[model samples]
Target chain A: MVKTHIVKFVGTSNFKMFSNHMATIVRLAAQQQQQQKRGMATLKAISIRLKSVKNIQKITQSMKMVSAAKYNRAERDLKQARPLGVGTKEFYEQAEIQAPPEDEKKLVIAITSDRGLCGAVHTGVSRNIRDALLADPKERENTKIICVGEKSRAILSRLFANNILFVASEVGRKPPTFNDAAKVANEILNSGYSFGSGRIVYNRFKSVVSYAVDQLPLFDKNAVVSAPKLSVYDSLDENVIQSYLEFSLASLLFYSMKEGACSEQSSRMTAMDNASKNAGEMIDKLTLTFNRTRQAVITRELIEIISGAAALD
Target chain B: MSAWRQAGLNYINYSQIAARVVRQALKADLRSEALKRDEVNVKFTQWKDGKPASKYIVFILFYLVVL
Candidate 1:
């Protein structure tokens, strides 16, 4: 019986890591005439695995709750600031500004979160920028990257190492404030990269479950100044126009950051909720398997006892 | 009266102003001493007595009760 147990256990390589204990018990019971030991061992294994799955469910459920709380405030913040971003962009359209000249440097600011596990959020932004660059190899060479989150930086830095201007870490650790966006905008303006135009690649929060990656133009200093409709505005000093450009850039970044933050929280909540549900379903399946196996062992033991009594008679 | 309002007319207003000021001051304490002091360095710890030497309030209460 012991030899049979070892052989049976060896064959149970296909059993799940969590199910290994159950498989061990099943193997031990393969040739045993009595049933108490095997039943206890197998039952113990199933219970242990069930407990772990239940713990996982608890963790996922709590994480979902935390993100759901954050989602509400982030949604409100994005809604409030979205209009200002629209207004800033409209000013550029009214000024009849065009895209930067082919010769000038292009900048892409990829906004992402420092933390991940929020349902493939950063990949969309990274993919969009990569695709855009691949589509235009000419612009790719001339382009520089400013990644707002470590996640995006890790992804893009590998491919566009030389083109990276700088990386801002510890972003979106909390709900983004305008000050946070302002600091990043200030860094870009001070870097003196002399980029002709800038583009922001961010996740647009469409609803609770869906988001889309999109890009918005951060009009260049030269483009804004050279607009044909510039003459319509009262005469302004070069320094003033430069400051206005900086303010607009900061506000646009703030709006995008808020929207992206909201999307992150909502997506995380949904992902965690789904994980908890899947864990529950797995637990249910395992419980069913455990019951069926236990019942079979019990019935087989009963039949063996009855047959042995008949043989004795 | 104008000077009084500048200083926050009564105790309630004055306390409110103080609370706001304290909050702002605390908010700017970005590199908090408490966080740095409490940071875990588990990898290189000496493992003295197989237990932590102190855990803030636990240390104080132990002295009060045990001694």
Candidate 2:
């Protein structure tokens, strides 16, 4: 009789790196086992692989739970923030404020988060900016990028480093505040780039498992003041307009950050859930292979013992 | 001049200070809930490598600790 015991894996700070390597190894092992090559050594290897996969499954399960908790808060917050964003945008639309078409200079603020392991949340935002950059050479030359998180900066910096004005890191580590948005908005206002117009590229939350990269238009003080319908509003002093621009920018940033956070949490929950499921399937396959190999070894030994006895007879 | 600017705060700090005041002035029932939104403990670091060695390691540690 063969007894199998699970070997405990001592996790380190570099566990993510270790788990990534284990995932690839498991894939290769699964492929090798598919060829039906069975032996005692292979049985031992399968047991070890099974242990690691089980450990990873446990981690993924816990990660899924954590993400679920975060998702609940994020979704709630997003509900409140959505109306604020919509109202701001509606004002801009009703006023007919748009960037002057001939103004070539543009700023692109890419809103993402520092953390990853969420399914393509950061990548979606970066790809939107990348597509815009690639679409027009002239626009690319005039465009300046302000990345809101480290993940997008890491990706976009590879090819468009020159285009990036500055990057804001440490985002999405905690729930964002209005104060945080104000800080980011103030940075943009003071960044000395003096861009004619801009658009914020962000991932809009659609559903629990899905998100779409969306763009929100940004206008400078000049564009806002130059709108044809501005004359309809009375008592609009310079101070009020300036204050509104600043406040509106912060509110828009706050709203978009909330949406991105909600999207990220939901996507992470889904990603971890899928990872746990895949690990379960892998463990099942490895267990099947282990049992078959153990039986094969036992039968081979029995055949040798019986043949030796027959020779003696 | 605003109280924040009088204390020599920059525009960024000034705006944040003002926001805090507004959150503080919410009604008793609403203030507690609104105050929750004021807490941000995010830490920032500059990345020198592709993997963001220092900050990424800390993030992973925190993630594991939470689990």
Candidate 3:
């Protein structure tokens, strides 16, 4: 009878253990189901984001190709135009000629890309312009801004609506012609807008990863003379100087446009590259979660089978 | 001029050198701060409706934990 009682107590304890194991299995199964559903949802979302990123990458890649083609041509023109522009400035210095004091209004021409996928290209140029303008207290009252791209125009208008004089659109995509730049320049010059000082703010492309914000002086030829001792016109004829100045202004405009294009292409490429990499990473993470949830479900099933076998024994 | 002369030379005080280095470091810090002023003013406009790109990773981590 004592032995029988001991066996009964042992059986009751085993039964309780079995019930606890079953409850744990139920709870685990429910948790696994929830986890699996969440993992699937995450995977689906990641796939969708990946597709969108791919489309963006293709668009940015095309833009880079187009910009590259335009940049090459612009760079050639700039190379030929830079020396002439320099020579023209030297002539003005040697001649000791001042642009008529009537043209005393300062003009700032800020160039940026029309479309944005380019990382920080537009922002950097805009920031440089803002900083330069704010640096000089006198510039605030007399300064007029001429924006080249639509993006730049929009930003400048929002920030300084009262100061923007004009905006040139759709010029960034194509090889900017001297005629187009001259037209913009002529309008500013003719509008009773004194060219007291003019500056062209744009990027100078050094490589795929680096660019510089270069401020080219548009007015006051003497500003170009960094040293006081150097002779301004020790090397050129008066006629050459006149021709060179015209060509140089045209070239400066062209170079800025080219450099801006190059910077835009590089920036877009980098942005897209990052986007694609991020998409890949997301897909990987989702895949990992999906696998883990799937394994947990299997583990719960294994636990149920083992518990059932033990009960049969 | 080699070993014998080198051994007889007076020991140099490093405090003067340390002071010069400290002054140079301070000057560099000032210059960098001036340059940083131009960079810091440019504010990045954030997307109003959606989560920021940086938050996406954190959201994924939370999702994984729940799963």
Worst 10 residues of 1 chain A by lDDT: A9-18
Query: Every model's DockQ, to 2 decimals?
Result: 0.02, 0.18, 0.01
DockQ of 1: 0.02
- How well is each residue in A149-209 modelled by candidate 3, as lDDT tens digits? 7778667666666677766666555555544555454444444655556888988777777
TM-score of 1: 0.71
Q: What is the total number of backbone clashes in candidate 2? A: 0
Between candidates 1 and 3, the lDDT winner: 1
Best by DockQ: 2
Candidate 1 CAPRI assessment class: incorrect
Candidate whose lDDT is highest: 2
Clashing pairs in 1: none
Rank candidates, DockQ, best first: 2, 1, 3
Error of 2 at B1 (Å): 10
Per-residue lDDT for B15 in model 3?
A: 24
Best by TM-score: 2
Cα lDDT tens digits, model 2, A1-313, are 1112111121211234455666566566656656767456467667777787788789888989999999999999899889878988987888889798878789998889888788778888999899889999998889988888889988998878778777788898887877777778877776667877899888899999898999888888888899988877788876567667777888899899999999999989987887777667667777887898899889989999999999999
> Roughly what TM-score does model 3 have, to 2 decimal places?
0.57
The TM-score between candidate 2 and the true structure equals 0.81
Considering the true interface contacts (CA pairs under 8 Å between chains A and B), give the fraction that model 2 also has: 0.24
